[model samples]
Target: MMDMRDIWIVIIALGIGTFAIRFSFLGLMTGRRFPDWTMRLLRYVPVAVMPGLVAPLVVWPAATDGDFDPARIGAALVALLIGAGTRNTLGAIFGGLATLYLLLWLL
Candidate 1:
């Protein structure tokens, strides 16, 4: 187990890192214009980031005996299908949560 001081250090590092990222963007964009390619790439950041962030959670879920779980895998599939069909964020969230809850309850 980590000590309180270690936890504090981790929290402080996270805070500093967050601040640095925000500040870097604000500072860089103060008076400078981003190039077309840079702007185009920035537009896809969320598109790229959302999947990257979500993929792992779905692909490798926890198990009772320390193994990968398939319950989340099914929920993720349902969520992906619903999102693709409806193209709505609320629908995707609720669909995913509902599927996860139902699966967890049943299994």
Candidate 2:
């Protein structure tokens, strides 16, 4: 068991590390320009990250004990279709949520 003092030390250390990381981006990079290639790659960061963040949850949801869920898969497909067809993020999210709820209710 960790003592309260040890917990506080860990918390403070993590906070400082996080702050330093953010400050390195904002403070250290002030007035600096990234290479064109870097900028272009950065623009796709969200596109690359979203799937990584969501794929595991959809593929093996904890609620299903890491099993695949059909409703979740359907929702992901609907969201992908909506987003790709209309290029509307919010619409895709709402469409996905609606599909998920409808499928869950029906199944």
Candidate 3:
């Protein structure tokens, strides 16, 4: 068994490490400007991240025990269509959530 003091020490160390890692970027990049190439690359950050984050949930939802659910897939499709058609993130989110809840209630 581990000692309580040792567990608390580890927790404090992890907290300090996380804070330092996050603060290091802010401290170093404050008032700094990046090159055009770097700025352009950074602009694609959201484009790269959103799909990676959302794709798995659409394909296999946790609520459905990692099985494919038509309702979840349908909601993703509706969100995609709304986003592509209207080019609105908020609208897409609202449409997706509404579709998910409606389908869940129905199915």
Candidate 4:
């Protein structure tokens, strides 16, 4: 029961804000090189971000009422092992999913 005009205004404002933030970085950092430390730190961004994004799903999945599931935990561990051993993201994801489904079926 909210006003459509208010929603539109908020959407427009968010769009403008997102564009400005991205433009600020792309416009100003066009040719400059980041420092060595900054570059190294940025290299770990994926490692940090991927886990942060997926940890919640693994730990407290919606279907389980936030209860701990051994199947999920085991599958997560197997996925980590596969990822670490192979250094392949897609392989790890597929392995994790396969393990999860197999475990779910059996347990």
Top candidate (TM-score): 2
User: What ordering of candidates by TM-score runs from best to worst?
Assistant: 2, 4, 3, 1
Residue-level lDDT tens digits of model 2 in 9-61: 99999999999998988789889998899999998887778788888989989
* Candidate 2 TM-score versus the reference: 0.80
Weakest lDDT window of 10 consecutive positions for candidate 3: 42-51
Please give, for residues 1-107, the per-residue lDDT of candidate 3 as tens digits: 88999999999999999999989966788899878899999888776787788898988778889998999999999989998899887898899999999999999
Tens-digit lDDT track of model 4 for 35-99? 89999988888888888977998889888999999888988999899999999889988999999
TM-scores of all predicted structures: 0.72, 0.80, 0.74, 0.76
Q: Which ten residues in a row have the lowest lDDT in candidate 4?
A: 25-34
Task: List runs of model 3 lying over 4 Å from the truth.
Answer: 1-19
The Cα error of candidate 1 at residue 103, in Å, is 1.4
List candidate 1 stretches off by more than 4 Å. 31-33, 63-68
- The residue pairs found clashing in candidate 4 are none
How many times do residue backbones clash in model 2? 0
A best-first ranking of the candidates according to their lDDT comes to 2, 4, 3, 1
* Tens digits of per-residue lDDT for model 1, 19-102: 999999877688889899999989877657767877877766444454566678778888889888997767887999899899
Q: State how far residue 90 of model 2 sits from its true place (Å).
A: 2.9
